[model samples]
Target: MKKQLATALAALVMAPAMSATSVDLGYKAYTSDTKSDNGGAYDQPFVKLTHFNKADWGTLLAYVKLENPGEVKDAQHGKDGKLTVKSLLIVDKQIGDTSYNFWGQNFLVSNRTVMEDNLYLGVTTNRKYGALFINAGVGLNYSAAHFDPTGASFDGISGYAAVINARYPFSAMGLKHSLSVNYEGQIDRDEDHMSTLGYDSYGHQIITTLKTSMTESFYTKLHMTHFDSWGAAPNDGIEYGVAVGFTF
Candidate 1:
């Protein structure tokens, strides 16, 4: 499954590059105070490579981050030298001349350093209302994970998943800006899988971002994230950060 997803992602990256409508690549740095249920807090700085691509067929967004780059050894959370990758692909088809469209979306997050991977596939509806655009769908969720020290592993179809995303763009203080929100939820989860993975049947995450362009090629963003019963430890936490980047 991971191999198949990787292949599809590669195709999206390469095929879209030939005639991409727009592409942006930049560096991002942020700090998060994310904590696990066992009272382990991961308040570390992270650096990432961010990429965004848009074309007639779809849009692709990816972030690859290295946790605690400055630390020589693992911190309290043992995340040093860890690499995390999160990506999303959306393919759309317009619904006649209306403001609605049909979309096929794929979201994947891989934390190879921790031996975890999550994949979600959804058929969504996208609609535009003036400057606000929204996309939502329900789909399937697959998860695989391995625990360290204990050496336990799990892999299977975990449950049903729902995804929602919204964006609104405007001008403020003479700068172009946008506000976007994203949500992902795991529902109807397999009880055994949830228990074995140390997560909940209804894990979810909500992220909000306020972004503004400093110039035509430069931008900044403020982000806030809230999550519960998600990730590796059935944890809940809130994180906030800022990022600056440039676009070409």
Candidate 2:
């Protein structure tokens, strides 16, 4: 299953390369309080790479993060921390549009540190209210996890997942700025499986970001994330960070 998933991810990464894609490369220094019994707090720098492609069929957005670039050896992530990859492909072909703007499928994949992987499939919709752009989706979720510290593992259908992303772009102080709010929730999870892995029956993550462009290609972002019954144990907390990056 892992190999198959990896292959699929490779295909996704390569698909954009065959077409016209916009890419961004940068470095980010973020502090995260999310941790497990073996993994402690992370206060290191990481490199981020993002890709976006829009075509007649749909749109694809993907990002890869190299976390803890050069950190001391740790029990959880080993010498160099870990790598996390996430991608979402939205098929936006109108399906008998009825003002609600019912788009097509939404495929989401999230893989982290080779310990946890999730796949989701469902429908998505997009709406705009003046300057605000909203995209939402609801889907079935399948997750596989292996926590080495406690020797606990889960590999099966986890539950239902939903996501909402909203962004408002405006100009202020002679600079282009945007405010975005993203929410993701996993509900109706298998309690037995989640409990063994130190997770609640439901998990939620919310992130709010304010981004300002210093120039056409350079920007800065301030981010605050709230975690509830998510990540490892003792997961309820707020993590904040600032990031500066360049876009190409």
Residue 77 CA displacement from its true place in model 1, Å: 8.4
Q: Candidate 1: which pairs clash?
A: none
Clashing residue pairs in candidate 2, if any? none
**lDDT, candidate 2, 130-243, per-residue tens:** 999998888887777766657677778888888898999999999999999999888888865576556778888899999898988788888887777765323566666777
Q: Model 1: how far is 192 from its true place, Å?
A: 3.9
Q: Per-model C-alpha lDDT, please?
A: 0.65, 0.64
TM-score of each: 0.74, 0.74
Model 1: how far is 47 from its true place, Å? 2.5
* Model 2 ranges off by over 4 Å: 1-39, 72-114, 232-234
Q: Which stretches of candidate 1 lie over 4 Å from their true place?
A: 1-40, 70-74, 77-113
By summed lDDT, the worst window of 10 consecutive residues in model 2 runs over 105-114
Residue 169 in candidate 2, Cα distance off native in Å: 0.1
